[model samples]
Target: MESAIRITRETEFYQGYIRFKMAVTNESPYAVNEVTLDFVYDDELLRVDRYEPLYVEKKGKLHLGSIDGGKSKSIAVYFDPQMCSKGTDIECNVAYKDYKGKRYIVQMEPKEISVICPIFRTVSDINTGRLKEILERLPHSESCVFEVLSSFDMFKLVNLSREVIEKRNVKHVRTLYTKDKTNYELWYYGKTKVNDDNIVIKLSFLAVQHTVELFAATQTAEALTGLLADVGKDLKVTIESRVTGKGRFNLHLINSKITGNTINNLLDQCNMDGTCDVNIVIDNINERTNAGRSSVNNTNFLNEQEEQRLEAEKQALIKIEQEKQESLQKEKAEKELLRKREEERLRKQREELGRIQAAEEPKRKEEEYARLKKEKERQEQLQKEKAEKELLRQREEEWLKKQKEKLEQIKTAEEAKIKQNEAQARLRMEQEMQERLQKEKAKQELLHKREKEKAEKQLKNKNASTCQKINSNNSKSNNKMLMFVVVFGILVLIVFFAIIPAASSSEQKAIDESVKGDNYYNQGNYDSALQAYDNAIELDVDNSTYYHSKGTALCGLGRYDESLDSYNKALDLDENYTAAWTGKGYALNELSRYDEALVAFDKAIEINSMDAQAWSGKSEALFKLGKYEEAQAAAEDALDVRSFG
Candidate 1:
């Protein structure tokens, strides 16, 4: 059968709880709506306590809203494994509804681990779906019988269960009667034996829990005496080899050889002190010795004859029981037929009476319906008017409230802009004042140099008389003065040509490029802004502001990886730049590196506690990391910062 929806489950174990992850996929061509999953499991074994996500869990039902065709959705449910029933296996069913409100159910196989006896498992640990493989292997070798008696009807028994009906095997099957009521003892025995000497596996249903019993015929038990011990009339053997790993034991007999996985399964079903006796049967232990070979052969031949007689008697009993059930069923069918005929006669009588009454009451019924309809229409009109008035009033109130909030936000933003503009104006005034002072100092130095040149030219024109006289009078003092003047002039020329011009051209041009990038960014031209910022960086590679602006432009282009590089460069230049820190956090979040994003956001907040962008980015990171409450708090902080900071 094709399913309308497909469900898969995975389980995870934690310190004190269990996590069950369930995914529901829609397989149909049309969408499924109102897809709610109602969990059904043994309440004694597990309780659906809470969720790993999808905050709402009510009475074990989860509302998944809607699923589009070919789409899948998943949820994780937490469980507390505490048992009230000792030998119960943990299984679950999910009931869900389709678009038309029709319900369907799906069953999940039991887990390998139990609540109280977690280390142990039975044939029940095998997924019910895989039981067919084990059963199909039984026919060629029905000489070995396997029976699993589980109270769960979920085993899908019709896949192939055959009755042995042999007197020898049926006698060993568990009794059908227990307590006051009858408990089903699902029994099956082997058919034609291919090789009676070899072992075979079997599965038949029986009780609330599952157990597998294996049987085989041995001609001479002496050959396999070392395999088991006979204590009294009961066979008792204890085999315990430690399984190396965790998880369910693999007991499916794909090969004839028994491995550690198979032994581990048997060990799980063993009783306290580690003894497993319920599974094995050896038929002819006493007849294996040669001393009693003739006597045992006579006894076995007679026993076979007697077994034939008993099998005939059991078949007779089954035939008698089938005849009894058929007789009862025939009687029941006659009674049902008679009752249904009587009901049909009564229904015809009622219909005849109804027709007669309807023919006589048409006018009165029509008048009453017309009057009722008029009254209903009047009431509906009044309701419509009242509803319209209420809706209008609500809309007016909501509109006024929204307008007030919008105006407040606008006012705050305008105030912030005004303060920024005022700061820029003060900065411009300072720059102009410094430029004027530099110009005044340069003008005085130029005038001093020209006057020195004029004085030297006039002295040269004195026909070398004054020059020779001064040189003759004070040659040593004159040389010292001349040397000092020449040195001072060279120093002034170097300052004018080297330091001031470099500051005015290279560094100033870089600042101009950075400002242009900011303008382009404000205009939402991210490509142009990025180009301008790159030009600025080429001119002044050490400036933090250029890198910060470049990061913003890269973010605008949705290039988060490169944006992260830019933000990191900015941070390396100025570790205390709050905007760079915030931008780095935002880029990290876009890259889905949430933990590192939180650190960046925290650092930004530490530098400037009122950074709304930092708070908002922190909120998003926390939400992605599954810290819902912390995310909510950070979101509220961001809102408050934006509204009033």
Candidate 2:
């Protein structure tokens, strides 16, 4: 089947998790259905922790419902990197059904993944032959090759190589291979294999001073080459033959043909006790053997050649030792000469320094004496100037004193004049205040008398009206009794027809005015509502409902004090009026009288437990009093009552 889906994926290691992002696109002309993705990886290397769609597990499968043609969907998978080894591979497979309901599967290529670990590049640029020679003499059984150079310390070289190996991920073990005061050896294992061979490079000191060796054992030349290639050119080595003084020795076995056994034999020959130098002469005696020579003569010639080689080696050793002694003597003489020259140079420098100091001493002392004499003259001049300044200062002080006394006199006269003027003003103000107080008292008395007379007159008129009403009612009752005796049915009809409708009409008119006031109050027109409520109260002075409504309107006008008075009046008319009590509480809360407000609210609540306004007013009072917990409880109660209603 032609590919219907195109998938691209990328992997990243972040915050200890290996996160994979995959972009899956439906490339076919038809929509894909039942789309799903499956991931697979080495369990030893990677562990799947989580995936998008939330429920994906190590089974590595994700179910994508569907994808429309030309549309794309993104999938993400996360795994723990710590669970995986380095250089593991992760694989992904995508399976989906096409529009025809035919199943199709796509296998994604496996991606190679690796974790970062410590690494150290190998070093080269070293003399391989001499290095091999030293490694052969070391107390080691493993087959190894080496490079030796004369300029580096063997111990330092070994330490540096160990440091590099320890930095890598390979498990390394170091052991004492050999122990000597001058010559030392160390063995290390758990070396990383190069070219499929377990090999380890090592360094150690040689018997010859200032000479070190670098060596490694490998099963194949290819392995050695691979190791050497990684070693690169960083480890610089310079080789010089002690006997020949020739350089450029290739350490490769194939090129040099000098095996480890050969090097060991050479070291044995050099190490013979009391022997200065011993050279082993290896010749191809077969090529030298001739048909004319006898076996005995050939043996004699070989022995002679060996004797000659031994003599030459002895002479070379003597020459070397003699030259070494001469060089040491020459160095000693040069050092003594240099020391004497340094002492002579220092002595001259010291004498010159003393001469310069001695010449400058008198000149310095004379300059010091001149400086002191000039300073003494300057001090005397400064003293004379100070004396002149003191006399001028005394004169200025006297003039200032005279000016201060004259100014004080002038100030005293001005202060006395100000006092006189202030006293006159005070006397005039007191007289005016007394006269005004008397006028105000008279005016208040007159107004009080007039008000009292007016109130008495109104009371008298009210009493007269009440008496007339009582008389009229009594006369009517007497007439009804008389008429009833004469015409009982007609009298009863007249009493009901005349008196009941008139009283109902008056009460209805008052109710209508109160209704109007309630409408104005509801519309937020406090002024109009107040006027309407006043008319209603005037029509029926004893109506507690009108008084309460008036208080509500006054509160709406922000006239809390006036509203309080109205509420008090309503309470007077009907002591159990809950609305008036709640209104009074609200007014007191607005006026910041929180303690009194709470009392009023409590009274209202006592009257009607289910009253939302009473509860709400109580909450406000409690909040003003800084009783937050009680306020919140009261607020909740108010909300409960309102919700129920």
TM-scores for every candidate against the unseen true structure: 0.33, 0.25
Best by lDDT: 2
The collision pairs in model 1 are 142-190, 146-202, 146-203, 147-204, 148-204, 149-205, 149-206, 149-207, 150-206, 151-207
**lDDT by residue (tens digit), candidate 2, 159-272:** 434443443333332222222334444333332323222344554445454444444444444233333323311122212212233333322211112143323323233322
What candidate 2 gets wrong by more than 4 Å, as runs, is 1-496
The TM-score of candidate 1 is 0.33
The TM-score between candidate 2 and the true structure equals 0.25
Model 1 C-alpha lDDT per residue in residues 1-645, reported as the tens digit of each score: 356788888776542345678788889877777666766455534656567666355675677777888898888776654321233334445555565444555655655443321111121122212322333332222111122321322212211122222222221221122232212222222222323332222323333433323332222222112111111001101000111233212222111221211222222333333233455221232223366456433221135765476466447645754685577567656755765696577557656865765675576567778988999999999999999999999997896566445434543453344335433743574477458657955975786688668657655654464455563547757666766776677678666656655665776677677677767876879999899999999998998877887998998899999999999999999999988898889789889999999999999999988877677778778877878678768867877887776
